[model samples]
Target chain A: MYWITVLVVAIMILSALAVLLLPNLLAAVAASSVVSLALSVVFVIIRAPDVAMTEAAVGAGLSGVILVLALRRLGLWGLGDDNHPRPGDSLQGSGDDA
Target chain B: MRNFTSLLFAGGLGFFLLVLAADLPVGAAPMVAGEGILGQGPEAVGAANLVTAVVLAYRGIDTLGELSILFAAAAGVGLILSGMRRRADQRPDPEGGFILLAAADLLFPLLVIVGLYIVLHGHLTPGGGFQGGVILAAAFFLPLLGRPGDSLNHAVVNWVEGLAGGAFVLIGLWALAVKGDFLAPMLGKGALGSLFSAGTLPLLYIAVGLKVGAEIAGLMSTLQETEAAEP
Candidate 1:
């Protein structure tokens, strides 16, 4: 039980860091989802199944969808949109950095 | 200089968070109102899942407020996105590929079943209205993602949401007029841990499930429909 708790917490921290540090915006969003999934695991280990289900469903699932849709409106990524991010477009900061 | 200052600020914040985390309980849930609830919740509320007791009986009105908040947020988004609705002259984005379409078709029914199970079994299990409702919304939204040009009937969606919300309120009002307390668990609680157990709680959850499912689907559909027009 201790090992499981430690492992879930570790994954949560790592994915949380990755959410901030990832270069690609979509990758960052995916990493954020990972953070949520790991946190849900932590909730289970803590015997908070209600919170775990909510975190998994809303945080990992719905929030990711919302963020990805927001990315579309903000002109970050899409399949055939006119406002697709250009190759030289730096995701985080000045376009020159990439 | 500004970068240095911000770095110092960030470092201080991190240190503060570390301090906060250091003495936290490792795996056990904190005993607060929960200790008492865990002991007597089933006897008092007759819900096998104590969380349902706390949510539906002890603090049911708060849940009602939460539902209204979600409704307001969805309405706000609709108000903002209404003007951005895709015009007939403008082209909508093409549907997703075969795999996405197939996945949507295959998964929708399965997801709906799982969502309903979670919602209906909430009194005996971990998940309830909110969790299951999100899954239901995802089920409803998947096909929309697969076929971006296709649209759900908004009028039907509106009616479903309105009726669901009204049902929730009417249930609370019925409890009020009958039991003299708003949102009190009424009817028979039945045998504990059974599908029919927990009286009006399951009914409340069903109303919540439908309302949240409709609101979330409506919100996501609006977001889908209000995409930037084609160049």
Candidate 2:
């Protein structure tokens, strides 16, 4: 039981970090889904089945789909697209100009 | 430097939280025994599931607020997507293969049944309206995964949403008339652990399930339509 809790918490932290570090928006979204899934598992271990179910369905499933849809609307399926610059890319140039 | 500061802040916050958590009870605090909703829920609300009792009976107004928030969000998504002009030159989205289409067709009814079962049995089980509603939305949206151009009937969705919302309100009004309080359970609390128990809790859950399902399915359909349209 203790080991399982440790594993889930570790995975949750790792996936959350991956969401921050992943360059591609879609990959980050996928990582965030993983984080949610891991968090649900933690919720289950802690005996909150209702919260776990909600986290799995909404936080992981629906939220991921909505985020991907938004990303698609922004035409950001891939990392190598020059047509749509990432959020931080334009800010880097502004810093240099100043 | 920014990374270092963020790390320091996160570590400090984590440490603070850990210290606070260590002082708290691990599970089911003794002070909370035989008090609040946990104590009075099953007896007063007569719901087999304490969570359902608290959500639909004790804090029903909060649930209503949550529903309104969801409705506003769905409306905003619809408004944003509807304003985008579709290009005439956009190509049609491709349909899925035979296996995918067949799987969707085969699984759709089963998904619907499971979703309904979850929604209807909410007062007796761990599953509830929110979870079941999402499942229903997924079931409705599954066909679009196979056939992108195929769309759900917006009229049906709107009617379901309207009727379910009205039913929820009417039931609350009925409770006000009978018990002199909003959302008070009207029907008698039947034998515990039975399907027919929990007075008005199941009915409210069903209404919530239908409304939530319709709203989410409508949102998905609108988003899918926007996606299929030309930029």
Which candidate should be chosen as best, given lDDT against the real structure? 1
Candidate 1 chain B: 10-residue stretch with minimal lDDT = B222-231
Q: Estimate each model's TM-score.
A: 0.88, 0.86
Clashing pairs in 2: none
Off by over 4 Å in 2: A78-98, B1-34, B85-89, B227-231
TM-score of chain B of each: 0.91, 0.90
Predicted candidate 2, C-alpha RMSD: 8.5
Worst 10 residues of 2 chain B by lDDT: B85-94
Ten contiguous residues minimizing lDDT sum, candidate 2 chain A: A79-88
Question: lDDT tens digits, residues B159-195, model 1?
Answer: 9899999999999999999999999888887899899
Calculate DockQ per candidate and list them. 0.33, 0.19
TM-score of chain B alone in model 1 = 0.91
Q: Against the true structure, what is model 2's DockQ?
A: 0.19
Error of 2 at B81 (Å): 1.6
